[model samples]
Target: MVKHTKKAVLLTLLTVNMIVVSACSTANTSNQSSAAPTNDAKATAGATGEKVTLTYGGWKLDTITEVIKAFQASHPNIEVKAENTPYKQYFTKLETSAQGGTMPDVLLMNGPNFIKYADNGMLKDITGNIKADQLDLNNFPASLVSLYSLNGKNYGIPKDYDTIGLWYNKKLFDEKGVAYPDASWDWNKLVEAAKKLTDTSKGIYGFAAPMMNQEDYYNTILQAGGNVISDDHKKSGYDQPEAIEGLKFLTDLIQVHKVSPTLAQMTETAPADMFTSGKLAMYFDGSWAAFTINQNQDMKNNADVAVLPKGKKQGVVIHGLGNVISANTKHPKEAWEFVKFLASKEAAEIAAKQGGAIPAYKGSETAWLSAFPQYHAKAFIDMTAYASPYPVSKNTSVWNTYETDILKNAWTGEKSVADAAKELGAKMNQALAAEK
Candidate 1:
């Protein structure tokens, strides 16, 4: 999960400004010639005792001040300068830097945009770096490591991971005389509870059916035995019956059941805001929002999380950011050094204790769970048993445009879900075909 502050903005950017990066080869090793550093590359680029400065670009740099200070204390020869851009503008800034040949030495990269940057010859191939240093790839979740890998070559070190969970307000449930959700809950139970909890007179909704993907519909699609992209990555699954059924479930909540906030209502105020304000009984969001949501005085004592309700089967989407080196960086060795430390247990521990996103480093999650003792945060980790990778393609940005444009009608109740899904599938298919 990119920071929650950037979710709506990033979603818009994906449809608007995300363009095909370059006409470069799509091979996993395409960047090796110019971007990958040789095995015998020196540890430092300058004189034996000189220092190297690395520019680290990411959203919310202030969250990791302690980690950066600790990194420099250990690697005294490397000075890290953080380039903190607001989450909404971070990717746009990165694109400008890549186009102008001034990408930061080290930067944070997300799963959806990873293939675009890797295929366009903008990111360093770090497979050799991992091999030469013998960094244990096992430290991170295999799914995340694979997400950052292209064809068998690793390009990034996964920094952290996040999964979606059901966030319910205990006070609201108690007030409505509704039982709290749990692992045993299924789609039928969720609907029954939602109907009971909804109160139109109080402007209170039972659930939130936003037009978002990762945090909302994608999980349901998987649970309904559907895929967003096909196994071979060449076709769209939106036109399939399973996918349409999954989508219709949410649309019906707004149009027929009248238990959820409409797209327009959620647009005026985010679902997360409604949840914290005690105007919603149940909401779905990523683990990345835990800390920020807990900051609400009322919610801090009244809310907790549970596994998402099962549909045909249980499923959730997993996504995370990785740290990658810029192909154009003059200091590959120093950049790799900085990246390696960022993936280390020490740094992961710092992030976990701060209640940041879930650390990808194995065994480090305990600290993160301890940071939020009031809630059942471990439900997020438990969901990993049935988690699916966030969907992507070589030209994901192209198809992303199709999803937003075609699906908005279904979300607004202006078009039937079946019709909207079918249109989206056809357009997405054409976009995927263009990548070949």
Candidate 2:
């Protein structure tokens, strides 16, 4: 997701500055008043013992609506107002609301953007709130819990998690007389299978390496024994020899081996579309795709999932969404209560039954696995043992943009992999330096 920036207007020293200051104050007050619950409203709810309405801002309209209904069923005194936005626009809306002190009472937070919001004091500090409400942090994986925390302060509760996996078209494998992927398959085994599966005359390719981070190169980087950023978040690891080797492996698939679609080819057709259309044999994608894939008759009958093939070691990238309350919310008590319920096992089960992304709460995955009995859903849950948390630092979007833009040159064969990595490493380090 992209970060949103608001345009600033220049003002003169005396008259213009006075007018601009007054205008901003008036606008901010007006926005906050309209966006949040009023003091009189809260008092009325308290005095009359009536239901209190809390606005929830997030993506995933269907799943969130289901979950909210469930919450309302149990908590009759609270009503949730969902302000759904597309993933692409969610952050932009959030950034604008936050600037105006008009953010919703609660919102979904992704790992890559969590630090930016938490650091800026946009999120409520829920460390004490969680304990006071008796919410079980033990229910979530330690890795995910750590992912949403900054400097010992917890700003969010893990909602759902996802991991990368290898998705293959069984029809193509059967046609070619090849076995399906399994734990025994390694990077070399995958390449061999891709070679046998590719049939140019039929307009089918074995795989697609689209220079994507989460489902593609990030896992490869970790499996190849390379890190994206230093553990301290103080340095970039792209220039390391192991990191370059990881990147080269992907570029080789597109430019050298010819078993995967070229960057140009994937540009014309998304890898997911190609796989679903039977134009690709094998693809790498997230577990979240299972919901849509299961709904496709052809895919449900002909496709299955497996653990991502190992490189030097078995690895995959894992990321999750966190539900957080707004620091500026007028009703902290009501918001905290809602956030607490949202993190509970009951809420997670609602998400699982709807086939939303894998619920982060332990043992809740069984419900999700059962939601799609036709596919190998267990592969995603099992991958957590060897998974690496999705890489991020403060201001991840800044360096992430650099990573994607510079690496495209290598993916397109316009620059050598090593040269591109070297340039990216320098530029990324520069961005990292500016974070603090």
Candidate 3:
């Protein structure tokens, strides 16, 4: 079942500090020039043969291109200009745009950043628009819808969702004469398999246990019955015994058992790169990795996935990106039309067949599963039965900074897991408490 939060109180918790500029300012004059008709004027303008152009911004350039082409084919009067930004700089660009009142008419937002944007009055309240358009919310999971909502108003429509899985090198498993991981395998089973598969001489480790939150330790923490943040979003759970156990599990794989590469080794080669290069036997990764793996001829043939091995119980962290609109957009009607179309069954089918990630729309997963028939694609969808929402407080980015810096000590063995976790908890609590 998906969790829910009461409407977030509008708080002055801005993740990015920028000088606020009004929409009418000189900085946004160019933005205002591109404004199309208002919702009520849209139909009349269309009848008079007016053309509307919308600037759409996102990190998924390739996928967005395909989606835009499909959208424009049917709605010939609407033109969409794609603004692609690399993920590393995407948020920085977006915040800058928001500050200048030059944000895109339609923008893509991920779960953690959605609340930050919505609470800051940067996103449109699309509840009335959605109701007026009669777009079916039933197509998406309630939990997913909840993720894009704040204080009972919808700010975005979910585009895709992801869950973590154990991606393994099938050739390595066959060479080692070990059975591939299955539903029956637990944490102990995974460790035993990793030990058998590790080859120090070949510089190949059994696994890649990078200090990542979503794809690595978070699942273990949830499976171990630990929370990242309290249900009320008022406290941190890093210091909890189960949460610490989860962190230690991954750290031990590097520092003690040596079944995974150390932090220094991974710095030389990223875990994903190592896995793709056939230097790692097993890696915990997200469903989105399917597209990357499938693109690589060598890894595509050898890689397969399994449900994440059970910890104390089966668990995986789930998150997705949503399509949002700028609150200051002049073409509310055209923007809503585009967003509604993107959330429709037609768009979901196109995305599913692209094999980038699973569409959040219900019943569209079959296409995604069929996109790569050789791999165990069903494992990702099936694991959703025990998936946990990606943990976030109102000030997620602030606390996330604390998570990475403080947890690195434990990951690198500079500090004991208990000590590092205790410190992380204290700092994280301070960040959460600062949020309204």
**Each candidate's lDDT (Cα)?**
0.81, 0.78, 0.79
Q: Taking the tens digit of each residue's C-alpha lDDT, what string does model 2 give over 155-269?
A: 9998898888899999999999999999899999999999999999999998888888887888888889998988767799899987898888888888888988888889889
Q: Which stretches of candidate 3 lie over 4 Å from their true place?
A: 1-49
* Off by more than 4 A, model 2: 1-50
The residue-by-residue lDDT of candidate 3 on 116-161, one tens digit each, is: 6677566778998888878889888666787788888999998888
Residue-wise C-alpha lDDT for candidate 1, range 214-239, written one tens digit per residue? 88889889889998988667899999
Which of candidates 1 and 2 reaches a greater lDDT? 1
Candidate 1: where are CA atoms >4 Å away? 1-47
TM-score: which candidate is best? 1
User: Could you arrange the candidates by TM-score from highest to lowest?
Assistant: 1, 2, 3
lDDT score, candidate 1, position 74:
91
Which one wins by lDDT: 1 or 3?
1
Clashing pairs in 1: none
